[model samples]
Target: MQIILGRLDTHLGRPRQAQQRLRAAYDGGQPPAEYWAAVGARLGIAVDDPLAERLTAADIAGWLHPDPAALDLLDELRSAPVQLALLSNAPAVFGRAAERQDWTRGFQHLLFSGDVQLIKPDPRIYRLLLDRIGARAAECLFFDDRPDNVRAAQECGMRAELWRGAPAARSGLRERGAITP
Candidate 1:
């Protein structure tokens, strides 16, 4: 079984710009969460209170256009025996994005840390993931682009890979015996 990632699967190339704005707000002593909400609003990302607390690297991506290719891949993925899940720190905005895609069927669970008030690299988040996915860490293979988060998952006994794509994901799964080659 795999806890598949979406936004953290690849760099969307939004950080420098988001950080510039965030730095200004942070220096001005505005709460980072508040500034993030403001920035998200500018990008047409809608947020609610619970989602405000669970921001992640993807939260800064205002330029997120749906990847038709990615969508096609997800559609195919849902047909597989592998269990698929969406684990992101994105708040309500993720739901909005999902609504836009009409692709809720791709994932068995939408584990939004924003709603849960937890973020990855935090062990609690991993526990939450473990519980939501109904598996011990050993039963799950985690994929993400962040090394630190990958490390965190590893420390928790979950097989994890820093995703490069299907090849890497498949390789990691097979290497760890989470899936057959």
Candidate 2:
């Protein structure tokens, strides 16, 4: 993701401000065209540039590929009868890409910040997730690599954990009786 973004930065004259603008707009639910338009406006590039389109496509493509081992772990949890859901701070393109993946079927619900226009660390997004899954906050176990996001989930009354890696996650789940050893 950074590679593509870095390319975009180079294409847009490497303005330091572009990084924050791109990240904010992308996480705030801007679609490809709109997102590129915003970046172009900020960086003084032509919004209709072909390079922007190419970069957007590349960024979405980057997001489409998931780690194979992570998918395997998801499968293991599914077989364990653990109800799984995905709550990610990603753009609408990511949500579209995830829908096309066979592994996504393992999730009972897939919520993207772009689809809902709500990003993580926002209490409202967590509430929306709880509403979508028909569960109380305390009933859910949330995991996120970002400390801030994990903290937000805890504030929402979830039993949240800072995700270290697959091994740690699996071990934690086993310890919590979410999956059998």
Candidate 3:
């Protein structure tokens, strides 16, 4: 998921245009990888192109630069007495990349939409994650970059926050008692 954002930033190099393409794909019910490919094609780029291949590969980490804010949050929370789970609307490639990163062990359970065919903002996926984690909705605190996803999580009875950056996220988590100030 973060890799997709990075690809949009670095490869496409047009934030607004990339966001529009992503939104259009979401509206059309396409998965992230398909959406990326479609966007590339629309830009006259081919799937065989190195950038496209890297974005679509199972080792997308090679093409990704980790977001420092997300890393900070993970690092801070990993030592807390709380469970961490990752619920991502990502493809198998993203999962493969995550497994290669030993630091991702911070997450006790990882769920990807491609693996389950259940995307975010979908009520079922939220239920699935909660169930797998043995957590009640009220006991979960979810953070997402998308408003729709945050709303959906709230609808499912979990505490949801729109993550803007490290500071805001840290403050929110602290307020929720998920971490110390």
Candidate 4:
């Protein structure tokens, strides 16, 4: 089994919302993306959307906390013939955040949307992961907090798990034969 994941789910580093909160600290509290984009005058990712707001790596330095069960999950994942790949919507800074975490290990590869310049729900991103690993969609499974992303993976023929957080994910994985300890 292959595991394709989101950054927040795989590490004890800056979580998605916590990263947003850290970003908001610098912004005027209007919503970090818009607030910081304006304050820093950081250009939008797209030239057509110059007014588009964005979040930066500097905004999230040490705000992330790992879920207690995360390591347990990783430990179990490593016991099997699993290929773990990270699929997140983050920049190099996000990877750095995980690097700062002592427990972030064992993942085979990382493919970030920011690095790819394309976010999830985009089939192309899934294709990129599959192509890199030489993994077939039929044999891969994706996990994410958003149903939309899950749906997208399903459409691409990869099994998708909509993360609602802990215990359930652990239980589901156990049933899938992806985890055992």
Best by TM-score: 2
User: In model 4, what is the error at residue 1, expressed in angstroms?
Assistant: 44
Instruction: Put the candidates in TM-score order, highest first.
Output: 2, 3, 4, 1
TM-score: model 4 vs. ground truth: 0.66
Per-residue lDDT tens digits for candidate 3, residues 1-181, read 3544445456555557666646444433455456566765555554444555655563465534568788888999999999999888766556667767866788999887767767888899899999999999999899899999999999999989898888898888888787987
Q: Pick out the ten consecutive residues of candidate 2 with the lowest summed lDDT.
A: 1-10
Could you give me the TM-score of model 3 versus the true structure? 0.73
lDDT (10s digit) by residue, model 4, range 1-181: 0111122235325445654543334321233344434433322222122332223433355335657676667777777778988777554456567756665566787775555656677899899999988999989888898898899999999999998666777788778887773
Runs of candidate 2 with Cα error greater than 4 angstroms are: 1-6, 9-18, 41-44
Which one wins by TM-score: 1 or 4? Answer: 4
TM per candidate: 0.60, 0.85, 0.73, 0.66
Candidate 1, residues 35-101: lDDT per residue as tens digits? 5567555555655555555553344345255456556656666666778777765554444565455
- Rank by lDDT, descending? 2, 3, 4, 1
* TM-score, prediction 2: 0.85
Per residue, candidate 2 scores C-alpha lDDT tens digits across 1-181 of 3444664657666556656657666876886777877766665665665665776777777777667777777878998866788999888877888888898899999999888888999999999999999999998999999999999999999999998877888888899888887
Please identify which of the two predictions, 1 or 3, would achieve the higher TM-score against the true structure.
3
lDDT of each: 0.62, 0.81, 0.75, 0.63
Q: Pick the candidate with the highest lDDT.
A: 2
Off by over 4 Å in 1: 1-33, 36-69, 171-181
RMSD in angstroms, candidate 3? 5.1
Candidate 3 lDDT (Cα, 0 to 1): 0.75
User: Among all windows of ten consecutive residues in candidate 4, which has the lowest summed lDDT?
Assistant: 1-10
